[model samples]
Target: MLPKGFQYAGVYAGLKDNGKKDMGVIVSERKAVCAGVTTTNLACAACVKRARKILRRGAAKAIIVNTKYANACTGKQGERDDAEYAKIAEKLFGGPVLTASTGVIGQNMPLDNIRRGAELLKKELRDDYDAFAEAILTTDLVVKKISKTVQILGRDVTVAGVAKGSGMIHPDMATMLAFITTDADIDRGLLQRIIREVTAISFNQITVDGDTSTNDMCLCLANGLSGVRIDRQALPIFQAALTEVLIYLAKAIAADGEGATKLMEVNVTGARSLKEARLAAKAVAGSPLVKCAVYGGDDNWGRVIAAVGRSGARFDPEKVRMNWDGLQSKTVTINIDLANGRESAQAWGCDLTEGYIKINTKYN
Candidate 1:
């Protein structure tokens, strides 16, 4: 079930040639505390630029999204278009709207179509989770969403998230597009801090082709509908629930990577620091050679070792040890030991296959 104070809607705005649902919005029953993490690419999209500014206000009533025209690298007009779209949404659905978009990077958004979509969405808002999840996807094979309820202050506090990503997925700020909603009352600064910390170990740990998108972002809203107030004493429970939702969606994105047949997980332990462990884990997971070995079931452990060595993590080569689950399964895990200290980290990616080559050759 969705969080109590939120409503969703998805409709076709003619941005996509396939006539699929390409536009969506999530509206909270009242003003909600909002937090967001966005792409670090210098050439990021207009939506990312605008959302960064809006997130600082720490409050919003709705989020409007569209796919099939990223509105990136389009010059000043793109920024104007993104602002205009938000204005249209605010005009119809009230004030303080955030926006997100994905798809081809250089095209300008169709303002007229977006206006029509906003008008339709005004009358279509409902609790149809699947519809909004499906609308945000581009190359994803299936919808990715999760909901969990935790006990907080003797009340049921719900946290829910939905994500969309298939290609151009790597983490600098956050990967692709994800939206989270919670019914727990939370401070805006605390919510932002939690999002950043969780994203580092979740979305920031996944890779698909190692190509970070120009429009990547993750946003969270807390409307306090559950009447459960979160303070330092109760923060752990709420953060843990949010972590579960984000990590589930992250793994879903990796497993659904374009033309990928299996998920590959890398675990690194016994490092001198968490940063070093993370560096080692991500190095192995993002290595195309290691991914190809997993795809072919080649059992080539040398590639993994080579990646770790070049990963800039300090560790003695003689102390390193490796183990692997059979590569033939739908999920493969690689275990490694730096044998240096107690720090550890994990990363996720998908096996590289010939299908990947085929899909990208005509991606445009």
Candidate 2:
């Protein structure tokens, strides 16, 4: 289900040879309070820069996205192309626009094709959520989306989101694009705070190939059409609902990791601080040896222990405890007791397999 007062469309404009949808647009009837978290990588895409600038103004009316040609490392031309696309979209949608692109880096975006795509998208505008989801995917095998309704201030508030990612994923923003929409009224500052906090526990706690991409980003738009004001008293409920939606999409991305057969959940407990817990959890999740062991269904607690030991988190080895109660299921959970403090954190990932190598190596 889509949030209120928004329209979506996805159309092909000669970007992909296979005729798959390569461009998508989401427009809100009213200017929406927007917040976004983007790739921390130094070689970020031009669209990332543009989006950040637009978001700093505090509101946006639409988001234009394209897949199959990340506008990264193309120098000034890439930046100009991004601006051009935004201009085209803003003119058509008649409001401020944010843009995002994903796919192979170091290539120039085909602006002419994208302009054509913008026209097609305008003509195709509808509530076709699935088409928008499909248009943002590169190597993902399935669509990742979620929707939930919560009662806030005696009003029904809806939160819906869509995401696309399969590989080149890691913490500090994975190689993915996610757009979250809501109808609850939230202040810009509060919305930004909630997005950052939720991302730390969700998108920032997942890994696929331990590589961050240049075009990764997660954006949230709140149009307040539901007439539900999320004041301080109602923040907790809204935050919980947002976190649930993001975590569901994040786990879905991990579970659908390229050629993965199992979803791996790493839990680090007894840490001295939240940072240490997150470090240990991410280390365990990104460890290739641990992932391979999980793939082969091996009870190799040693790999998990080794990952934690080198994670820069101080802990006594002898006092550490390991559990693998999830071995019998497709979802494997590895629990680590650091025996250092009371804090705990979790990270999600996927098992490594030979198929992963094949898919990446053969990818054009």
Candidate 3:
């Protein structure tokens, strides 16, 4: 079940030509503690710019999103349009609205369509979680969402997350639009720290394409509707739940990437540091050669080793051991032992296929 005190709505706003739902709104009954991680791409979207500002306050009441026009690289007008979008959402939902946009870059949003969409969203607002999940998608084949309940201070707290990413995904602040909500009362400072830490091992551990998108972002809101108060002692439990939700969504995004037919998971161990372990795992997972090998069911173990060598992780070639399992299945798992230290990390990615090229080349 979804967290309490939250309502969702999704509607078509002419942003997409096929009459697909392209606009979505998420509102919390009251202001909620909010934390966000956004794309580090220099040319990020206008919505991302506004989102950063909103997140700095550590509180938010609603989120408004659109798919199709990324609203990136559109100059001053794009920023103005984002401002207008926020004004409209704040006017409807009260205040402190986060904004997000995804799809083709270098395009401007249709102001009229957004105005109309806001009205439709307000009128249709309900507890329809699926609608909100579907409306945020662009090329994603399925909706990504997960919910879990945990105990905090003798109360039942819930955490739920939804995400969308099919391509242009990489390990630079998530590389997708992910929204997570919870009903636990959490210190905003602690929540922010938790999100950043969890993202490093979850969303930041996945890659679809080597390119990070201009509109990537992840937002987490805690409304305390469950009456569960989280203290330092209970932080670990909440963090684990949040991690599980995000990792599930991350794996889902990798599995459904563009035209991917298989999921690739890499495990790197015996690293001198956590950073090195992450670098090695992500490099292998993101390597086009490794992905193609997984796609073709080839046990090209050398490609995996080559990726690690250049991953900026210091390691001895003689001490490294590798194993590839399930290469012929829908999911391929690779294990590597650096045999140098105790640090380890895991990364997720999709097998590269010809269909990926076709989908992107024909994309408009």
Candidate 4:
């Protein structure tokens, strides 16, 4: 379920030839504080640019998203299309709106279809969270969503999120899109800070094919409808709850990677700093050799060691302790001790299989 004061709707946009639900909207009854983090890729989608601009205002009332046409690499026309979508959303929803798109880069968006879909979405706006989740997917096989209620200030605050991604995923922000909604009252600056911190440990620690996409993004909206102001005393609790939601969605994305048969977890400990630990963990998670070894169920700890060695993290191989027994349970935990400090980090990824190659080779 979505947080209070927000309505969601998903409709078939004709952007996808299969007539799948390709457009969705989330509208808040009142203005909400919003913060977003987008892909660092140079070839970003127009929707990403538009969302950044809207977030600069520090608040928003609606979010419009479409899948199956990423609107990336379409040059100036793509920017126009994104602007038009925002305009349409604002006109219909009566407030500022942000936009997001995913799927099929280097192609022009079907503007006419998007316009029609916007109309249908307006009419279908309701509390259909499942439909909204289904509409935001491109190649994803499952709907990734989580909802949790936490007590703050003697009131129940709800936090819910949805995400979509399957392939072209890596650590510099996974090839994924996530939107989180909450009913806790929080300051914009603090909310943004929490989002960045949570993202660093959650979304930034996952990988699939080691290829980042041009449309990756994660956004959060706090509508404060629960009448609970998150003071400093409660910030830690709220942040933990929010992090839990993001980590769940992140793991779901990795486990559901295209043609993935199992999930892999890499742990890096005793690093000199958090940065070193993250670098080492992500390197191991994104290493194709390590991924293949996991897929074959081979006790190839050498590949894991090689990945960490090349990760640019200062580590002492003599102090590294690897445990491959976790492979029997479809989990691989590699502990690398740099013998430098006490910082540690973990990353999640999926094994590479023949099916992954087949899926990507024929994907269009």
Candidate 5:
């Protein structure tokens, strides 16, 4: 199902040994005002660099994505492959295209298949966003998509999003690629700023594995067809809608983390700053000790305490407090209230079971 005017296509590009669906496209009839965020990994993929360059110019009519080889650390060959793919997309869309790539790291792309796949997508672009969602998944077991509508000053608008990733997760921005499209016309500067803010709290707030992917990408496109131009007054409403979509996808990614058996929420409260809170949460969320405990359903609050200690956040351990299960049950009170802190925020993750180990060891 599609949310609205968005058109999509997914097909095999021969980028993997099994000949699974690899190439996909998301397109709009008119240029879409776009904002994108990529991996901060110094070793980013060629496709990541190319997409940023294109979106920097103006609006985009299409997003070309593939899953198989990450096309990272392949040097000059990777750059050439991404350039060729962009050219193929440009010809097919007859307009500017945004490219996104994912899969195994430090690998080269099969440019021939990518070019052929782009041609195929041109012929099949339809209103099937689900097909597009299925095409981009790697280790994920299910396709992720969500859409919502809200009224802004008596005007109706829609926000539709799709995402993929279940492993290599924690890759820059949780190793996922989410493409969102809206019919609202927005200024590029404002759109970029808002997208960044929403993504930081959603996609960037979750993790499974600690490794960041070289080709991570999360982008949103606003074609402004709804005639609801976002003013400063409308910005908060817009950001809230965007953040909701991203957080939904982020939780889905964690729940489906390869072989994950238990979804866990690690919340850090009473921090002096948001950044420190995030850092503390990340440390707790990524700690193997904490994950293993969750896997076994063991209420070991010490694991949480140890995680906080190593979180690189400035905190007086003697004055820190902790809780679990929403701070209601299985709660262990650590009387460190001398530090003057009492608010909380949550991070998403899952247990690191042997099942996860088995799946990653065998997955192609």
Candidate 6:
């Protein structure tokens, strides 16, 4: 419902034969405090590597992006696309620029279209969230946008976010490129803490597939357009709002997961520690074997249990437990109860199926 600020044009970048909107720009009207989280994949995309460096100063007024080709493995020239984008943003917006890209892997980036997209953006920048949403999606079945208005320093501030990932979405920093923008005045240190806290439980907690992307980037921009300062005192509120956006975007990504039909929430509990719990959960979430079982609706708890066992986390098999959509699957769940301790952790996830394979095949 964000009235779309930032005009957008989807001039067939030829990256996708479907002629979908691919290249786009989201520019804030003012300098905004920006916080971003990138993929931990050692072979990160050229765009992700550079976006992290650009957002370090906690400010970026414009974001340039493309979706047909992942700006990865392009060698030194790929590295150059990052700086080229910043330069593009500067030319169009007269401000600092941040860039992000996600699509086919190991393909050369489309720099000429990117440059043209920037020029098109300059001629048509507005407050239309729809245009922005359309521009960022690749293989997404629908447009994605999440926003919330909350009190910051006793003043109203808005946090709006959008993401695209119908595939390659195991976000240890999640495989999707998500950008969040807000109109709150926050310094870099506080912005970093809030973003870190928000992403930990939100983005880092979900997985459609075990595959993490090289181009995953989640960024938050706070331009103070709402006239509120998200000072340290108001950190908690800001964190909550940011977390809301992250969770929304993550779920949307999952719901739109390539060939995904039913979205799921797996909660892993009764672990000795949080880290152990997360490892166990991720193991279940990322397991294709477990996912296939879920896809078949076979009520398979052993796969879940097996995944947990292999997670390298400690837990008494007798003390571990499992549930499907909150109902205890007696024949399928694994539980190990601690004889004396009162600590445990839970994780979230979904099922996989042939439809997933079919979709990728069709899309390609």
lDDT of 1: 0.88
**Decoy 3 TM-score against native:** 0.96
Where model 2 places Cα greater than 4 Å from the true spot, the runs are 167-174
Total backbone collisions for each predicted model: 0, 0, 0, 0, 6, 22
For residue 204, model 4's alpha carbon misses the true position, in angstroms, by 0.8
Q: Among all windows of ten consecutive residues in candidate 6, which has the lowest summed lDDT?
A: 326-335
Evaluate model 1: give its TM-score.
0.96
Q: What tens digits encode model 5's per-residue C-alpha lDDT throughout 141-214?
A: 88899987877889877888999876542232225788998877789888888788878777787788887767
Count: clashes, candidate 4: 0
**Per-residue lDDT for 71 in model 1?**
85
What C-alpha lDDT values do all the predictions have? 0.88, 0.87, 0.88, 0.85, 0.76, 0.69
Clashing pairs in 1: none
How do the predictions measure up, each by TM-score? 0.96, 0.96, 0.96, 0.95, 0.90, 0.87
For model 4, what is the C-alpha lDDT against the true structure? 0.85
lDDT of 3 by residue, 1-364 (tens): 7899999999999888778899999999999999989998999989998888888888999999988888889999999999999999899998899999887777778999999999899998998588888888776788898898887777788899999986432112224889999998998888999999999998899988878888889999999898878887888898889988989998999899877999999999999999999999999999999999999899898898899999989899988999999978898999999998999999999998987877767443
Query: For residues 22-93, what per-residue lDDT tens digits would candidate 1 score against the true structure?
Result: 889999999899997998788899989988988899999999988878888889999999999999999987
Worst 10 residues of 3 by lDDT: 166-175
RMSD of 2: 2.6
Better-scoring candidate (lDDT), 1 or 4: 1
Model 4: pairs clashing at backbone N, Cα or C within 3 Å: none
User: Candidate 6 overall Cα lDDT vs. reference?
Assistant: 0.69
Assess candidate 3 and give its lDDT: 0.88
After TM-score superposition, the amount by which residue 16's alpha carbon in candidate 4 deviates from its true location, in angstroms, is: 1.3
Give me the runs in candidate 1 sitting further than 4 Å from their true place: 168-175
RMSD of 5: 3.6
Off by over 4 Å in 6: 1-14, 152-154, 168-175, 326-346, 361-364
Better of 4 and 5 by TM-score: 4
Query: How big is the positional error of residue 74 in model 5, measured in Å on the Cα after superposition?
Result: 1.6
